[model samples]
Target: MAESDDASDSILPEPIRSVTPLTGPHPDAEMDVIGWGIFLGLMLLLVPLLPFIIVVWLISKLVEALTPS
Candidate 1:
């Protein structure tokens, strides 16, 4: 029974382990450029939100005008 269990365990295969040694942070130029691109893309994504902001502001003004302090 013990032999069968051992054989099954071996047949299942162990999880792969990293062979490379752990090193400190590695900052490369290409990675830096990619990071900048992602940042720019995020900022550009805000362009579509402008109309929503204006609509909300206009609604608030309309509500204030109708409520009469």
Candidate 2:
């Protein structure tokens, strides 16, 4: 069992084995701000539109299913 575990660990990539948690400030604060701003803006704009999008998609799929191929 120990030999099998060692073999599995050896097969993993070096970066996967050496992973570490972030312990310092973000490398680029400006980029972080811009990224978060864009993410939030999209969420705000898309959440309300989601229901309509889903309704449209379902209607299209229903029409496709009902029509002869």
Candidate 3:
């Protein structure tokens, strides 16, 4: 029983550990610029669609208003 316990303990591998610390907080220019450009482009595209969304919303509201509660 003693030998079996020791054998089992030896067979199991040790737990893995890792630690990653930030070395710097500087923003990456290329990634930041690309991300911002994509974000701005999306916003620009969405802005033009705002009026269409408002029209749809208004139509739905008007329909609901015309219908009985």
Candidate 4:
């Protein structure tokens, strides 16, 4: 038992363990404010534009109906 203990201690000079987890992208990653702004702005624009888009589509359909196939 003593010899086994000595062998194990000699085999590893220092304890090989990590106190903190390996640094990963999730921990180091940063948010992109410009990207967020662009996407948010586009979403805001889309909400207002959606009604106009539908109205234009309806008008186009009406025009199409007035014309021959």
TM-score of each: 0.39, 0.62, 0.55, 0.46
lDDT of 3 by residue, 32-63 (tens): 89999999999999999999999999999999
C-alpha lDDT of all candidate models, in order: 0.89, 0.92, 0.92, 0.85
Stretches of candidate 4 off by over 4 Å are 1-31
lDDT for residue 2 in candidate 3, whole number 0-100: 100
RMSD to the true structure for each prediction, in A, is 6.4, 8.4, 5.6, 12.3
Question: Which 10-residue window of candidate 2 scores lowest in summed lDDT?
Answer: 12-21
lDDT of 1 by residue, 1-69 (tens): 999999988796678889998899886999899999999898799778879989999999999999967
Runs with alpha carbons beyond 4 Å of true place in candidate 1: 10-24, 51-69
10-58: candidate 4 lDDT, tens digit per residue? 7856778989889755632245776788899999989999999999999
Off-target runs (Cα >4 Å) in candidate 2 are 1-26
Spell out the clash pairs found in candidate 4.
none
lDDT (Cα) of model 2: 0.92
Using TM-score, give the best candidate's number: 2
Provide the lDDT at 20 for model 3.
Answer: 72
